[model samples]
Target chain A: MEYMIKNKNEQLTNWVNEYSDKLYSWAFYKTSKKEVAEDLVQETFLSAFKSFDNFKFESQPQTWLFKILNNKIIDYYRLLARNIEQVTDDEFLSKKTTDALFNNSGQWVSAPINSQWEEQEHLLDNVDFTTVLTNCIKKLPQNWRIAIESKYQEEKKATDICKELDITSSNYWQMIHRAKLQLKICIEKNWIIK
Target chain B: MRFFKLSCKKATEMVEKEKINGLSFIDKLRLKLHLSVCKACRGYEKQSTLIDDFFLKTSASDIDNIKIEENPKLKETIINRLDNES
Candidate 1:
């Protein structure tokens, strides 16, 4: 038992030495601040080390690290906006999104801007996507982040996220409203080719 | 062009609730009009989505500049600590 602990400690340190920089960069994508990202990455490693004994190797270690990092990012946001006033009150299920990005009216309640796409739109050429995305997400209002993460990551229904956040169905829609606009503004400001 | 000529804020709400019924008929007509001419809006929509897609792609392998500090002394320090603990 003692020998196993010693070996595990050595392995854990090895993992950090090899993975810290990469983990740090990934964290930067979420926080958009170097210091905050580094702190989260280091904390991720520390947490992993503390719980090394329970790691059953069912999945890759990176997967494990990411789950921890995701939780940490959410926690950071929760702290950043603790004083915010929420308007929604539903407990579970979202007000919409049962259909898809496009709704049934086919009229699009929130019409997506349709434009002619160029050939280069699909290119993912080892670009610094992380930096670009992190900068954009950071500019998002706290409500936008809350809405996107709940819908996209947590897979919670809109109603439920609204309930948990104390926002209304209307407020929930409004938050998404503002978020998409900001995202469009951010993209125009940062990504479009001249 | 998409229907739902929602305002930036209203558009975002529409997108969030994933709703389609609340938009005015004129709103839909205008969105279609805009999409027909704007290349940039198309790009903007793609970018809006990348925020979510990026999260899924950014596993540990997506990290950059990860290299172990190759100092022999660090290895020796570990060995010493191991020796002492035993």
Candidate 2:
């Protein structure tokens, strides 16, 4: 029993050495906060260690570790949203104003802002532009960042995200809407218009 | 009354909704009707789709190369915590 336990410890230590930096990088990107990111990465390793037996080895260790880390990030985002919810009654008022993308008579309040994305796909080849987008995404409010990341980056379903985050469907959609709008404006101002 | 038709606000919301969930047949028709007359909303729809595509492409491997600054002691701290738990 001691030998088996020792072997498991050895393997876990190797995993910590091999994957911790990559996992921490991904978490830090998602959270944009150093301490929070570190804590999430630590929680991910601890969880992975606890569930070592359940890991059937069908997937790469990196994949399994990332899956656990993604859940931790999602839970962290949900916690942030919950805490933010407690202090912001105007959240609903702000949501209603998200519709202000258009005017009272149903016309766009301004010209279409997304006009210059013709070279956007090519921007993917430009590493600096990609970093700019990441920075822009990180600037979003926590819940909006969570909504956008889960929907587009993580490719999760609306129902699943809503349930996991304990958010109403209406609020989820609002967050996505607000996130995309803000991202478009930010990218346009910082990248395209620049 | 123009009450039955989709407004620009409603049309854009439907466009975002279509990204998350499929639009209903009537909602689709409403969106189509709105898009037919509104060039800006069409621009919004196209851009929204582009943003989704950008996100997917970005996620494919962005972290592989990001040089995130690391705390040298974090791994040891985590392993120590795990050992304590066990």
Candidate 3:
């Protein structure tokens, strides 16, 4: 048993030497942050080492390492998404901007702005529009941002996000709804008019 | 009239909810009824769906093309940590 553990450690050490750079490059590419990418790569290797026993070697070691790194990236975002300290329940419930969408009788207070988005082809291909969209996403409240991120980036189910964030399903959908409304307003303000 | 009437606020909420969890028969019918008369909610639905598609496309396309130089010390740091763990 001691000899086997030593062999495993040696194998992992060799992998660390060979693949760490590639893993770091991929992590940096995904996150676009230096410290976060380095931390994620470190965590990925640590996790890979801890679970070395389960690695069947059916796949290339590099493949296995990249897979582990991908999961670590997901977990990093999940952690960020869960950091909702700046967003409070009251703020979630009473966002004045979204509230301003409707009137006392629950009708639209003003006509929903006619979006020219449909007229534009391949809007995402336009770097300026993407930059604007990215900024708008950043401007969302943390919880709302998580809701959008989990839905789009992680492709997670609504129930799973609610379960992860410990929010009710109603709250989850509401966050998404308000997020879209705000994004629409922001995009219209920044992209269309500008 | 009251039974078929759904508030624009409620109609928009149902529209978003439908994307995640499909609405029930009554809620769906009410939303349909409200939307038939309300052009603004219809516009909201279209714009909201467009935003969702943009998010989906952005996530799919954005990250893979990034290029970066790898950190030299990462391997050393990882090796040191592994040594401590064992």
Candidate 3 residue lDDT tens string, A1-194: 98987888899899988888778887776666889999998998899889998899787898898888877777776676556446676456538878887888888776435455545677667889879888988788766776676676466655565566554567668778888888877777787633
The lowest-lDDT stretch of 10 consecutive residues in candidate 3 chain B is B61-70
Model 3 chain B TM at: 0.81
lDDT of 1 by residue, B1-86 (tens): 33334443233344434441244567556555555554444444555455445544443233434442233443344344434544
Off by over 4 Å in 3: A1-7, A17-38, A73-94, A112-116, A155-166, B62-64
- On a 0 to 1 DockQ scale, where is model 2? 0.57
**Model 2 chain B: which ten-residue window has the lowest total lDDT?**
B1-10
TM-score of chain A of each: 0.56, 0.71, 0.71
True contacts kept of each: 0.14, 0.51, 0.65
- Residue-wise lDDT of candidate 3 within B1-86, one digit each (tens)? 78888888888988998887778898888888888988778878887877787777766654335454666688889889998888
TM-score of chain B of each: 0.34, 0.83, 0.81
Output the number of the DockQ-best candidate.
3
Cα displacement (angstroms), candidate 3, residue B26, comes to: 1.3
Return the lDDT, model 2, position B49.
78
Task: State the TM-score for model 2.
Answer: 0.80
Lowest lDDT block of 10, candidate 1 chain B: B60-69
| Model 3 RMSD, rounded to 1 decimal | 3.6
lDDT of 2 by residue, A36-122 (tens): 989999999888888889887677999899999988887777776554444244444444455565677766677545456533456
Model 2 CAPRI quality = medium
Score residue A154 of candidate 1 by CA lDDT. Answer: 42
